[model samples]
Target: MSRLLGLLGGTFDPVHNGHLRAALDVCEAGQLDQLRLLPCHIPPHRQTPRVDAATRLQLLQAAIHGEEPRLVVDDRELRRDAVSYTVDTLHSLHLDFPAARLCLLLGTDTFNGLPSWHRWRELGELAHLVVMQRPDFSATDDPVLARWMRERRTEDWTDLRAEPFGRVLFQPVAQLGISASLVRQRLAAGRSARYLVPEPVWQQIQQQQLYAAP
Candidate 1:
């Protein structure tokens, strides 16, 4: 039985519960064999984080600790460059796991802005994309994104049970309001971010006193 793999890319400045929820939902709902968390070195569109690459990876490892054996943490992007590109990562993963079906998991907001990414339209042929609903976004809000989907002849996609990546699939997950930035903000304000991230990660941050004034 060939396994289906989900690639979730993000800066993961401080990997939080929401991210975990997203990955878990996508994996289980999509009938994926595994879900790999890809933490990018450079997010490109967003402001850079105060934490470095290694620490970010540490946090991710700590966050997904009790995840099922199917969930994996892939470090290729963090080791790749100061400026990361998704298409490049996708190509590399394709080569590494030729038999596994690959699908990209992303939030609805990012999915709408996919065109702004480097060579976004061509991505469809390479990987199956899962566009999930976000906690703060409404499906009826973006006419342009809707229009773009129309242009691609990708609309009328009423099938949530379809396999992603032509062999995989796109499925909806429970919307979570948490974000790494939000966790950082809470920590910075000296608030309780407990349960926001894994305890091991929180302990590591405390031991190292991360997010403190630089």
Candidate 2:
């Protein structure tokens, strides 16, 4: 079987517990050899983060420090000056490890809004989409996406293991109602974001005095 490399990209403004849990859960579920947590330099879909890219990268480094074997911090997107598009990142990964199977991890919310993304259709050709199911939305709610899901969805993990790319997989993960925005809100309001983020990450944010003001 070909090796599986998972990519989980986000702004990772503070790298919270929800992000860690989902990454760990998906690594086990997908049987990935290593999962790279990519922090986006610029997000086209949302407002620019209050925290700078450097700080976010530092926080990501801190969050993934002891998670070496299963998780690693990927700074490719941060190094790229242009807007961080998922397809572009996948294409780069495909080039770097052409023989290994590349899986792009995404939440259900992001998957549902795929049409709005830059060159979204080409994403499947570059890497397999592993959409983690969320409670608020379903693929069937969007007819176009539902049809695409029907055509490309894979039921067998072995099939993913055999191929290098081009398939979609829906996974059920623990529903944690935590988000980066919420974590920022709590911190900015001078409340405890202690359990929301990892210890090292929390310490870094506290020491740097980040997100103390809205």
Candidate 3:
């Protein structure tokens, strides 16, 4: 049987609890064999990460240390000296794990903005999209996205595992009101970010004086 692999890509400027919680929720709920946290070198839709790639990777490693064995870090995007497009990443992952079913995790906001991504139309060919539904966010308003969702959406996890790609699943995950930007702001303002991020990540930030006000 093919393994069910989950991919969660982000800048991960400081790898916080919200990310971990959502990942854990999806891993358990979807019965994923493994979930990789991919840190991008350059995010296409958002501003550059506040921390450098190496530092961000370090924080990510620190955050997941000894937490969940399945939640491992993949630095392929950071290693590549080019734009971190999800399409390219998926292609590479397909090459690496041909038999594994790929599930690309996304938040509702990211799913809604999918039309604007590089080679967005080709995404379904590479991996299944698992949109993590949050209580505060609603379904996509874009007609194109809505139609796409209607056409490919699957209510069952088995449907995703049965195929290597070309399916969409909206999963309700634990909603934590935490953002990396909020963590950075607190650190920059000399406020504590103890509970916002993993303890090791918070310690690393303090030790390195990362995101401190200029």
Candidate that would win on TM-score: 3
Which candidate tops lDDT?
A: 3
Q: Residue by residue across 164-188, what tens digits does model 3's lDDT show?
A: 7889998999988999899888988
Is candidate 2 or 3 superior in TM-score? 3
Estimate TM-scores for all models.
0.85, 0.96, 0.97
Clashes of 1: 5
Tens digit of per-residue lDDT, candidate 2, span 1-214? 8899889999998788889888888899888999998999999999898899999999988888888978988899999999999889988887888888888999988888888899987988888889877666555577877787788899777778877667999877777789999999998889989988999999998898999984
Off by over 4 Å in 2: 135-137
Runs in model 1 lying further than 4 Å from the true structure: 140-170
3-93: candidate 1 lDDT, tens digit per residue: 6677898988888778888788877676777889998888788988789989999888877877757778899988886578888888888
- Model 3, CA-based lDDT: 0.92
| Pairs that collide, model 2 | none
The alpha-carbon lDDT assigned to residue 80 of candidate 3 equals 97
Higher-scoring candidate on TM-score, 1 or 3: 3
- Candidate 1 vs candidate 3: which has greater lDDT? 3
